[model samples]
Target: MTATKLKPTLGTLHLWGLAVGLVISGEYFGWSYGWGTAGTLGFLVSTLLVAVMYTCFIFSYTELTTAIPHAGGPFAYSLRAFGPTGATVAGLATLIEFVFAPPAIAMAIGAYLNVQFPSLSPNVAAVGAYFVFMALNILGVSIAATFELVVTVLAVLELLVFMGVVAPGFSFSRFALGGWAGSDTFSPAAISGIFAAIPFAIWFFLAIEGAAMAAEEAKDPKRTIPRAYIAGILTLVVLALGVMMFAGGVGDWRALSNINDPLPQAMKTVVGDNSAWMHMLVWIGLFGLVASFHGIILGYSRQFFALARAGFLPPALAKLSRFQTPHRAIIAGGVVGIAAVLSDGAVNLQGMGLTAAMITMSVFGAIVMYIMSMLSLFKLRRSEPQLERTYRAPGYPLIPGIALALALVCLVAMVWFNPTITVIFVVLMVLGAVFSKLVRGRGAIDPQLATEV
Candidate 1:
């Protein structure tokens, strides 16, 4: 049977804003900054390479975005490039990255705020942030996209201004600080210990492709989604490279050695006791990351909605609002969020259910999805030679091949670097596979129910 066509509804600016704001400055960079600062100069250099690798994989995603330009984003691309089962697997992997990221970002809001008001309970901050984000998301995506655009602009402005302020003040000598073969952390088992830290370095850009998942809702998705995906990735390149190179130059490794904070430590040195202005800057940057997470939840909900509608997940999740919004899917995403908040004192999930845990599962999922996407990019080029592409992936075979290689390395590194989370990720993948079989055997995820969602 010929597949039904579904287009996404986001515009260029909105899609780009959603991609850039949430992915570049969101929790990944915020958290990675802290982790990077804790390591030595050697580790910092390697971390920068990871940032480079992220851009490489992004080239692959960008190609897919331009080619498919449909609602399911990666899933849809894979479906067209591969098949249904492949699409579901890709969707699951993409789902892993974000399903927990929003909650984690909300928790980070509490943590970042805690730096100022140590006594403010994380529970209150998380719950408050979650509800606000939820409201923005449910109000229809355009509102959230606009908010993200504003936040992304502010964030990019802040980071750029901060870098400019520090640029002329930089000293190249400070980056010569020492470290071993493994990352900055030293022990008999240093190789794995340092590899374990790779994710923290790469995490900054984890949510970059999120907008693609919501491509169905993107206005003129073919045009909008591709631009958004590229712009979002470029945002990361500017932000990550800007911060890394800028930090290494202007900030002394001595004061920054014990601290994992890029901006705080830099502010302390440069601003030097200008407590008022530094606090203002830090909070703005921090909150910007927190606020942008609305994009992540937005993407995840749509993916689940697509899955449900396509007969993979529970059909009830495919319900739409009067205005055609996937109200049920959005709410279902939020419900898990409420549970996550209530689970372990609000912030505990950031540790237990986050990057080293569920979030890293997302990283693994992204790798799997990315590799498939690379293959799909290649296949589509051959399968539909006549299909139009706005932004063809530069270097074609070489670009896609490198992206696939980088994806494999990162996955291997993730496993070697983070065995504990690695095991959990494999277990989850197995479960997803098993569940896929179970759902298929059940005959259309619930055949008794009407197909009227």
Candidate 2:
């Protein structure tokens, strides 16, 4: 398979937009589910822990991104450190994380739209979103990146607006009510609840590292990636904690815990149901979901194109269009996401909706990818000591060590709490291994493509 190159059109601002836009949706909706499992206070502890993990992980992960500057991101890092098998595992995990995440964000987009148009079906709206964003991604990287920047800025401003509008109503008394896992004092149950809420807390900063996939398209990537990643994580951490705290304090936190539109509900308590601010939360808030949905489309397509170029997936998917974009790969991922949206009611787990289940599954892939990425960092540090690294992870081994240790704890907690999802994830990994083995047996592997970066 011939290696196709992505155009160098993204700069630090575009990279920052992609990094934050790819995850800003988490601040909009899914993290509220953590409140259901761990109440406000318990979930707060969970969020803090996960935030620390992401901060350290991004710091360490930047070393690999700058040295390699590959569109394959984690797959390329692992390939350089390990071999084809490691690359295959990382590729599959990344595919799952990027592909599954869009469908969940799409559903959130649809739900927000449905609030305005009561007659619209959310599933239909979700599939429509897949069609529209995939087209935008296929047009060109610069256009897509520009759109991502505008929407991300709008999304970030809306969150700030939300906080300002609701601040007058925020009270410590309401926030502390049932804060410790529904108990006045912390206990073993509260500890268990914090562990169980790990996946939800992780939802906050899940895809910030996806910007690494755009490094090949970056001008002077080594300088840009670190700036984008560090700034993006810091921005997300502040917004996430602020949004969660204010949302919880404005009303009965339990009331906002189980729903998709927690921000709107939280705003209702402060401004009433018919207030302009409440409407703004539902309307402008769509930008957050749109930003994430559009950015992930770009992310997943690049991963698909990179995998296909490296002979892990069908080479046909690596073909560039007249516009010099991975049109086929973009469409392929959209098809998978649309199919998931169509099968919404058919596959339900633990009495949760398809969106929640998809979030858990995506988090499963993200955790696996994180583990492989950190391990790759350590291996490359020892094996290729001469590799050009424009940015080195601060605190060396200790920072990444904390990230890896926290990721392992979260993975164990997720597997214990979501046994069915764990089985499904394992089956997917096994299938990926089998496919890689068969491709190798047929002599379809391309060593040149693996080292293209």
Candidate 3:
């Protein structure tokens, strides 16, 4: 049999999958797990801040993507913008984030699937889903992309139901939120509670900037990218915050905390014990979870495949499919994810499974790269002013500058409270730095790529 590589164009299903994946994994499941129903208001406010910040960043990335449409997103951009050393470090950190993310998300899917569908064993369901994800990758990007669109629509519709009709029925005045203030559950509740509950506030908006990674596959790098980015982000926010607020208004903080899955439990109170609606709503939530995991797996596999192709990881990990997709890399990435899930399932490991730390590090790494990329922009303007730009950042220095500063602050805040994880981030940085140099001579990115800007 002969082989073939699938040629994908911009603004396709694969592109949509990349963006929608970020929103669901970043917002829907991430927030619900961290902040709980009672913290809806606070979580929403923080998320709004993140959303606005990331939206601007996405625009900046869109401009970059249009200028250079390729598979390796930040790595490609950073190398062009920054010098070799700088870009290499950024790429490594990004690779870490994308690689580790699959397991964390897969684990979450396992937990939630168990919660909603008690019939299937969690491990079996998780392992099955992981394999299914691998198969989906092999089925080709066309099928995967279509699934992304369907999943995205389902997630959005579910949110509308929760917020539009159900949320407004309850009184917001009755909600009490003094729990974090006056409570005395001193046993790891303060730090761990925030870390544990951090899902609500932190995970809600994890890797939104990853949308730019799929810019090459987007319909129109200039138009579809920005519009879809705005619409997609807004859709998630309205759903997550809206449903959360509905849940909060329907019941008090005490009631919300007691229920692990706040959305369904809260809906039951508002709907007057309607088991049918609860079951339907809970099933939708699970569907959203599945969609999210699907999206995350896509991102991780693309990253792994992309990095491997670029010569960062092993060459065997970089092989492409007859369909032009990175089949071997995707399968390898899925296996790693399955392993993480299998181990956790056996040991009963819980609480977002290194997600908190992974997110913290990824965001921090991205912020650092953003700062470097911005600086690289200036360097490019000075060093290679005549270079062509397909899409220029609207407010080059100003907008990029603000993004850099905000990212720095976010990174700083994460480090302030998360020393344990911060140290590990340091170790990853050192290790990635070393690894980048190892591939520099032959397989790694050409130093000239960085200077091309």
Candidate 4:
């Protein structure tokens, strides 16, 4: 049977929405967890370092996305630069990043909702969210993207409202009262906390690169993709800084640092617990989680479909539905996410809580993808100088070099600080390699289709 292709229907707006929506949830929750690891001051330093890495990474990654313009994102770039093995590794890492992230976000969503409705169980709510969003995704890409755009716009506005509400209470003195959180100045413990905070700091901008995965379905990807990526990253940087500063400044950062729903908790300090603003935050904040949860589902589906179409995964996963959506891939990813949520009890390695542990694993995947994609960018520039390119990364070698170096540092920090998750990541990589080899050995992939895009 012939493979069905994703419909090209997305414009720059949809791309922007998806890009922002895929990561907007970070503004609401995960990054605050960094405060628990490194305290306010230490996490701030970590955030600054991570911000630099992502800025450089996005600029460099844009060139690859525009030049290649495939749905595989990093996988496509690595496939062109380093062949199938590289593609497999990149694809698996992308899967780990995209697939694992939603469950964590879903848990946050449940926690936010449960605060509003004391009767609701977080796990049940999380599972329900998966089903609802997965169904929305299978409807059609345009419809799904339109939903993404709407919810993302609302989510962005809510964050601004949050900043405004909390701004009146913002106090530099309060923010710094326990900012260092007992970590000695320049001591080994302080140094270790900063490194350990790297993953949570990365939570601020983890999946912004997922924008490139929609290239195949985006209108004029060369122009649209680059613009969306640049615009999206800038928007996120502003929001991340705004939310972090205001949230910590308004009240005790320590109180909300380890919670799944930090924004609502932080807002509670400025507006009393019973205030309308607090209620608004809990209810409206759910949209932020939905935006990312839905958008990432769109992203991982495309990544799965691309890898399958390229012969790296089972051919069935590349199959499209009557609506021209990657229904199989979407369902497959949903299954994995649901399984992660259900197995939360078993997967809470290192006592970081399920959400934190999952975030660590996702960050681990992201670092690998970043390192490989940057290497692929360098390889492609050296090996295919004459290839067509509409846009080149502004800083070229310097930007990509900086990104690569930082990604390596983050990887080292992640392994050193979170050994349990690191071991799990290694096992996942090995399993992926074995599965890829077995599938290829069976001649299950169509060579013609593999090279089509």
Residue-level lDDT tens digits of model 3 in 201-258:
5455555556666655566666666666656666655655566566667766455543
- In model 3, where do residues sit more than 4 Å from their true spots? 1-6, 10-17, 33-41, 179-202, 219-223, 254-260, 272-274, 345-384, 442-453
Comparing 2 with 4 on lDDT, the higher-scoring candidate is 2
Task: Summarize candidate 4's per-residue lDDT along 1-453 as a digit string, tens digits.
Answer: 675677789999999999999999999999988898888888888999999999999999999999998999899899889988898889899999999999999999999989988899999999999999999999998999999999999999999999999999999888777666354658777778899899999999989999898898899999999889999999999999999999999888889888898888888888899999999988888899999999999999999999888777888988998888999999999999999899877765887888998899999999999999999999999999997889998877999999999999999999999888888899999998899778777777777766655
Q: What is the lDDT of residue 184 in candidate 3?
A: 37
lDDT of 3 at 131: 84
Order of quality (lDDT): 2, 4, 1, 3
Which regions of candidate 4 fall more than 4 Å away from where they truly are? Answer: none
Instruction: Give the distance in Å from residue 363's predicted Cα in candidate 4 to where it truly belongs.
Output: 0.6
Q: List, residue by residue over 46-93, the lDDT tens digit for candidate 1.
A: 566666666777766776776665556677777777776777777787
Poorest lDDT segment (10 consecutive residues) of candidate 4: 176-185
> What's the number of clashes in each of the models?
14, 0, 18, 0
**Candidate 3, residue 130: how far the Cα is off, in Å:** 1.2
Off by over 4 Å in 1: 1-9, 26-38, 165-170, 179-194, 248-262, 272-274, 341-359, 443-453
**What is the lDDT for 379 in model 1?**
85
- Per-candidate TM equals 0.84, 0.98, 0.83, 0.98
